[model samples]
Target: MTQTGSYLYAIAAPVGDDVLGGLRGVADEPVRAVRHRDLVAVVGTVDIGPDGPFGEEALAQNLSDAGWLAAVARAHHAVIDGVARAVPAAPLRLATIVADDDGVRDRLERWQDGLRRTLDEIAGHAEWSVKVHAPQPADPDTDPQPAAGAPGAGAAYLLRRKAVATARDDALARASAVAGQVHEELARHATDARRLAVQDQRLTGADTPMSLNGAYLVPVAGADAFVATVEELRERYPDCRFELAGPWPAYSFVTVEEP
Candidate 1:
């Protein structure tokens, strides 16, 4: 028989039983709450046998499988996202597992203060994602007609190449400057901002190069205005492509132990 472990999804302020009703977590197990003092931990039972997906040895192997990882991640996020909709919850890192309910309570007791602070910090805020991509500048047109076989022709060709390279660099610098301005303007409308590494074109499958990958923490009351600002920036900078996604749980703003 497979041994079971508790998969912790999130720590939240006290929540009603209905909040967990109809929710299925990793392994399709029903999610339940374990309360300790003023906090509740949302968890579900998962197998921890040597061959089971959540087992220490098996988990490392399973993470290498993209399809399996995606399905499990969706289930984990689904549970926390559902709870966040009705209460202030701090999501645990993906794959947080313990021996059993007693272990979960012990964690709650140990981390209650930090968890409470995190929940308070994100109580009425949501994370917003914004990406700005700019088309790569075209290479400078070169007139390579330097009279082949003529004196100094080789030197002229080298000069043209250098000029072309310089022009491209300058154009990229200008585009980078514009991206900075956009981020600064958008930051004005948010409570907090985080700049993420820009994704590669191959991964994004975008024809243009990304200039900015940013996440913002915005109050619910200001969500509409924040979205409007994004649209306005999009129009103001016609050269850049803008992507906005929002009203999500504050995943980027919280810090939790992954191990």
Candidate 2:
């Protein structure tokens, strides 16, 4: 016999049947709420056996398939985004699965207290991401001009390398100081702020190295102020660049861990 399950996306205040009826989740499964009192778990139907996309075996196989992973991730985000509009919600980590409706109920029951508290904390707020990058110094080897009346080849090459190293270190120190000030300025407009480890240049497709990657939880009403503050930072640090993205659902603030 084949077993079936539900993939849970988020938990929130009671979502009406009408609200759930209009949406679909992963695999185009209709979105629905499995309610236990005032708390509701948003779920989508899934097959749990080896043949299914979300199955234990299938998950491992698909992890490296970028296209498949992107599609599933987008689907998961869609449900959470829609739910957030109707009610304050706490989004679960991607690919959270339960054995059945009963399992969904049990998980919700265990998390009921935390869910309520999380909802209250996130009420009327959203998340924003701010990233700052420090420009890379020009490669000394690119020019490689021997200093006036200096020795040829070997000595000149060593001198150029040392100069490049010194410039790179100086740029990094300046960027670090600028990043700290930028974070402090942005935090003034946010209810909560976090400094995340900087992402690699390869991942960010950044021309320069990332110096600061921060997420902020800002009140919905104050979103404009938060963005304006980020803009101000850009002007303050013209050498370093900034990327501000959001009014995203409060993903950074939802701290619930699955039991």
Q: Compare the candidates by TM-score and give the number of the best one.
A: 2
Per-residue C-alpha lDDT of model 1 across residues 76-175, encoded as one tens digit per residue: 9999999988998888889989999999999888887788788898998888999988746666665655697899888888887887778767656766
For model 2, residues 1-259, the per-residue Cα lDDT tens digits are 5667889989988878777787788778998889998898999988778888778999888867999889888988899988887889899888889889899898879987888889998989998999989867656676658766777867777788798998898778878998899889888888889998899989988887899999998999999888888887888788898898987888888997666
TM-scores, each model vs. reference: 0.88, 0.92
Query: Model 1, poorest ten-residue lDDT window?
Result: 135-144
**Model 2: lDDT of residue 86:** 81
Q: Show model 2 residue runs off by greater than 4 Å.
A: 138-144, 147-153, 257-259
Give me the runs in candidate 1 sitting further than 4 Å from their true place: 142-164, 256-259
Q: Which residue pairs in candidate 2 collide?
A: none
Shift in Å, residue 101, candidate 2: 1.6
lDDT of 2 at 203: 98
